[model samples]
Target: MATAKDVAARAGTSTAVVSYVFNNGPRGVAPETRERVLRAAAELSYRPNALARALSFGRTLSVGLIVPDIANRFFGELARALEEVAAERGNILLIGDSSQRVEREHEHIAAFVERRVDSVVVVSVSDDPDLSAFADAGIPVVALHPLSESVNASSISIDYRAAAASATRHLLEHGYRSIALFNGPTESAGSRQHRDGFMDAVRDLAPGAAVEEHSTQIARAHAAQVALDMLARPSRPRAVYCATDEQAYGVLFACHRLGLRVPDDVAVTGFDGTEHSAYSYPPLTTVRQPIPEMAERAIALLAAGEERVRETVDFTLAVRESCGRHGTDVAS
Candidate 1:
């Protein structure tokens, strides 16, 4: 409970000088006096009130980030990239995990607004999240997922449909006669795009090949459980394309438990190509999202004083061991 008064007393300065030093204010202090004040504050364990400073200065020099699930690898990577960018810009990043709950997302949003964060980045659970609160508070927000046009926030995301189709087309190129789509459970805008791209690829491959759809939560354990049951059946798919790396890893585990060799007995592809995908038992073939680039763009957009604009980035398909060789050999 040490206050600025105690530090000012120890530093032989008035509280006004301490305030000016802490807030970097209208009045300038000599370097020696600033060092003395900082040393006294450190010795006395004195802390300044962030709220009062923000109320006066209109910025906390911080950015808030709300993600659906911080445990998910894709969001984890995004958070890390954003942190790096924020640090370079002399801003701190505060992470808030919604844990896939809309109420929790709202709670974080309200808290960030009350705390007066300079801006926010969110990956909301709902397709149409309540962004008006932040908009009213004049806090800029950027979403990392597909958002509706009416959401009134800047968005930076890769074309999920095209990425899904590209990965599916890669599977088709391998001539996997029976392909499966392991997609997200909810039929949100993102999931719909994934389905659209997947179906587009299937239709282009045409009537000769068979396609099936499977749904699971975006977690490794859940996806593994679902994949295990599906792969246990006699008519299991020859190749599976998962919407996320977590689901893809789960499918890989299911293949191992079922004694089905990957890219031999059954091939698999994954989206959201995180770094860990390369280290999976068999390096996975996945659609690589430009995470660093996306992070930079999203932060820049949120920092910029411009009208809301939605932008879509491109994704790259990383062909690897799990998708099998790219030769003319047809899948069994």
Candidate 2:
């Protein structure tokens, strides 16, 4: 059977347009586009049974999820956890990967709204995404990160600033003075929190510790490249605090290639504790945002139909071989 994506391809338009032509109304399709969609649907024998059911029951039974990069292990884990939880609730998850592009993010936003998914979960590329379309469509939304109070949506996220600070403090207690912060590429809400938290630790713990910051695309390869350049410098910091485990892996890779030992030469800590963190060359110390717990709460919040529910979850610092045998896990 032809799927909406198939019809979209045949029509030379987006799945959203096919949805608009089939579901009608949340938005209008241009006459030419509508003709193309109809012709494509008939030729492909496309039937939107889901849309029909949604209309009949007044609920889509599907939830839309938007993430910056689906391939990133953190987001990949998040998607999988969300899928499992949503499945238990009798709703399927429709995921859209924004490829870390604002325009691509916009496309997914429009597509989700047009398809009239019952609700949405966003791990947006932007710090402050435009939730107006979802708001106008009356679809409930829950952001996995903090959001401005002005936005008409709920948020469920770990306290990133505190998480970062805790990780940095752990590194300081390890007696590494000069530390570098490997942060996300953009200076958004997340990056700002990471920066502030890192500085907070430096100011209070190490006092005059040497610190520097570098930004990279949230990918291992990009992070490796950045790490190589930064670590190649003669005065490279003795320890590094990475915003994500993926980046920490890159730093580890750089250390290997540069003949630097893990804690002996350059200690490191990471955030977003994907399972891979435990098995890295030197097991990584990281701040773990509880994925399963977060997913359960997010799904329950959407199911409850609460207008706006802002919630925070605890993050655990997994002390492992990477930051020098801190063996105990700390939760906050």
Candidate 3:
């Protein structure tokens, strides 16, 4: 609870001198004076008022991050990476979990704009999220998903279509013709990209392949229930490609409940290769999204300025126990 005045009083200096010393300021303080102020601050355990400073400078020195689900491991890891990167660049990260609600996401947008965060990084619950709040407030934003060209915001993401193709091709090359796609609950731009990529792979590989598709919420529980119903069908897919690692885990659980063994019975591939994916009952075969790199680039773009950048990072197919290493020997 030590204030600048307390530190200044202890250091035998004016509050302005203390402020100058703390902020490294508009006016220079003598080295000896600075040393005394530092010693006094240390003695009193003084901390500068961040809000006051932000008010003075017209910047909060913070970035706002909005994700649909923070409980999901992918977003959790991304938030951690972005926090680290922001700290490295002398800024703080404010995380907002929309919990898959458009209203909640809009609430976060308004909140961040009201607080005057330097910039924002968004992974919207809806593909066509209204970013006009940030735009109207002149707050720069970068979306971490595939956004439509009409939205006035920067974006950075991997090619979901290509990544989807890679996962599907792995199954096809392994001779699993009856493949299925377990996609997100809604037909979003992101989901569409995934679907398009999946269909592209299936069609290119097998001229007349019949692929089944199912949609569910990204949560493991919802996906689990959905998978349980689907996998019980007599004509269930030979291999299933999931839109997310969370959904894949649900399918894995469903297979277990139905007394089915992975690869031997039903092959599974997941997208968003989060770290925990490797620790699944049978390590997952997935498309490894470059999370850390994506976080870094997104933060960098926001920090540098919002210049309407569109970028695609690389994605790799991580073949492991779940998908069964069939035709290819690649692993990660």
Candidate 4:
């Protein structure tokens, strides 16, 4: 309720001096004068107009984040890390969940453009998500997943194919000849990479291995429903390699419902090794994407205001109890 004029009147300084103090100024104020303005503001509980300052400076000091599935633990972790990085640079983060819908994603895109956010980071449901709205609005955008060449945006992620291959090979090494791959909902670039990596690993390591692929929405419940039927069959897979930690958890639930023990009746592996994965029943053998490092890099890149850059972060295969291992050690 207190205005700058009120504080200025109390401080015996002009409103321009208050502006200089609050904005850190186009013109410098003396230390004594600055102290008087601050004291007066504290007495009157004066607040500056952030929107007015942003309008004048052409920066909202906020970052927009769009995630495909907010309920998925992986995305939640990514958002948390991104939020921290954004906050460190004095930027508030605005999150939009698309729920794996392109229309929802586009709505968020349009909203971010309209808000005039300083930058945007997205994990789109589509490989070639149309970001022209943000592009036309001159807002720099980055994708956390691989994007098609036509998308016109920067991307930073682990090599999905390589990460998938690495996890699949680990399952193969444990001698899982009859394996199944649980993938994301569609045949997007990321899903294809996962499928390719899975098949490639099977071909190279276990040429005669039996393999099948199943697609489901990137959620625990949907994946569980699909797995419950497949896992109940007489010729169920000896092991399952999931494209996400969420799906892997679903398969674990299915196995539990069927009274099958993990790494004994069947082995399992997952991608996106979220922190909670470590506490799963048998623990989770997974590929750990560096969410914090990737988030830091993405935020820093946008803050740098340079040409958008394409970069690949590293991933590790975290060996744990979910997949049968040779030793008691549980580490990458």
Candidate 5:
């Protein structure tokens, strides 16, 4: 393997000039010298040492991303989007899957801090995730969910309450007098927002709508089990609004197991419009969070500085077969 010294020797330049050319640098190299270094590097296939650069510049040129459940389609897509954006910015993204465990989440946080990642993007399972570690280490954090002001971090998320309300309203428009809410297990800020939004929609738009709420782990199997019992009730809801597509999929499974037809017997709507949602049995109608846009903005904000800003992006309701949309008409 060729080294920077070999490239510099072939280019007839000092190692410092090579460093300036490769690092884009503290010191300027002549245009002609820069071209020479590039040509020699191409011939020698010499690669710069990332560790050496990081040691000198105090930046790993990497971002750490922690998600509650990587197996969930929503987080999987989010990770991919974040990785793309980070790569475009000349940085690598390190992903840590917490699997809904606080201890595991903390372990990832510590690992990132030890690795000296420039910043972190987190989707924690806890309401008040301990960010003091990152704060003390001077590593900025950007959460992808609703966070309290006391957390000492920035957050970028869509208005979950409003989004949830909108989805519930869609069911109401379909004349679903009885609607059920399938929310996440934990009582985090994000969960509260989902609950508030769901109730608000029922109160404001469908005052007479009979509403029932249930909670389950984000896993599809767990949600399926919870849904099986819910749908088996004599007073089962006509429509269900899920906090996530994962849960919605489980609801669909429960519906099938009970020999109930979708949109005919019961309708369902999901949050997080992942691509897989499109391919679900009945094509789920969902609230689409802008993953690419959110990822790009989050990366930009974290890379810029530790400016404690709470940002909200736009979300859209994707009308599809599951919600029983008539013609081109969609429930918003």
Candidate 6:
């Protein structure tokens, strides 16, 4: 392996000068000297030791991300958007998938802290995740979900309750009297917001209408199974509002299996309008999170080096074929 000493010799400079060039310095090197050292390092295929550099500069120029499940299309799209923003700022992004496990979330937090990543963006599995470890280590963090006020970290998220209400209200406007809410597992922060918004809309629109709540895991397959059973019932809902596009797709599949026509027999609205949502069989009507804008703003906030600011972005509802709407109209 090529060493810093070899590059220093090749550049005709002291090892300390090479260190200053690579670490961006406690002391400045002349621009010409910096260029010479960089050229020599490149020619020699010399890479700075990340550990040594971190010890000197206290930054890895990298951001750590922890998502509950990367395979989920929403998280995958979020990761891609965050990566683009991070890259534009000359930072590398390291992703850790928790796979819906709290232990794994903690493990990733520990790993990122130990590795001294400059900042982190986390979408935690738990409603109130323990992030004091990162705080103690002086790592800046931004949660992409509603966090407890006591947690004392920056958060960037849409108003889930309001967004859910807008989606459900759209269904009500279409005169779907029998509506059901297919939400995430019970007792979750996200699930509760979705359910509350859904019920609030239904109560205001049709006081005596049949409204029910169904819980399922965020996975499409599991939600599909649950929806199949639910739709098989004679009292199945005429319209459904889902907390996520994944679950809405599952319901769509169930409708297909039962030979039911969408927006004719059943209308469905989904949240988290990923690109794939538009490509579904009936072209879903869903709530569109400003993911790219949110990702850019989150990275900017973390990079700003100011810890006191928290930001919340707005969401929009995309009306399309599935919810008895023909054109793509946005409601904010």
Best by TM-score: 4
Model 1 has a clash total of: 0
Candidate RMSDs in order: 3.6, 9.4, 2.0, 1.8, 2.5, 2.0
Q: Write down the TM-score of every candidate.
A: 0.90, 0.84, 0.94, 0.95, 0.90, 0.93
Candidate whose lDDT is highest: 2
Decide which is better by TM-score, 2 or 4. Answer: 4
Task: Please give, for residues 23-100, the per-residue lDDT of candidate 6 as tens digits.
Answer: 788799999999999999999999988766766666788999999889999999999999999999878899999988
Better of 1 and 4 by TM-score: 4
Please give, for residues 187-236, the per-residue lDDT of candidate 2 as tens digits. 44488889989999999999889999998888888989999999999999
lDDT of 5 by residue, 1-332 (tens): 99888998999999888999988998998899999999999999888998789868888999999999999999999999999999999899999998898899999999999999999999998877888899999999999988988898999999898899888888898888999989987554478889999998889878877888888888779889998998998999999999999999999999999999998999999999999988999999999999999999999999899579999888988888998964342333
240-324 per-residue lDDT for model 1 (tens digits)? 9998999999999999999999989889998888999989989998888899999999888877867888899877888888989
- 2 or 6: which has the higher lDDT? 2
Tens-digit lDDT string for candidate 3 (1-332)? 99999999999999999999878898999999999999999999999998788778888899999998999999999999999999998899999999988889989998998889999999998878789888888899999889888898999988888888888888888888888899996744389888998998888897576688899898889989988998999998889999999999999999999999998999999989899988998999888888888989988888788578888888888778888763333432
Cα lDDT listed for each candidate: 0.88, 0.90, 0.88, 0.89, 0.90, 0.88
| Pairs of residues at least 3 apart in sequence or in different chains that clash in candidate 5 | none
Off by over 4 Å in 3: 326-332
Runs off by more than 4 Å, candidate 5:
4-21, 24-44, 206-208, 327-332
- Residue by residue across 206-323, what tens digits does model 4's lDDT show? 9999999999888888889999999999999999999999999999999999999998998999989899889998999898888999999999989987676778888888889899
**Number of the candidate with higher TM-score, 2 or 5:** 5
Task: Compare candidates 1 and 3 on TM-score and give the better one.
Answer: 3
lDDT assessment of candidate 4? 0.89
lDDT value, residue 289 of candidate 6: 92
Worst 10 residues of 4 by lDDT: 323-332
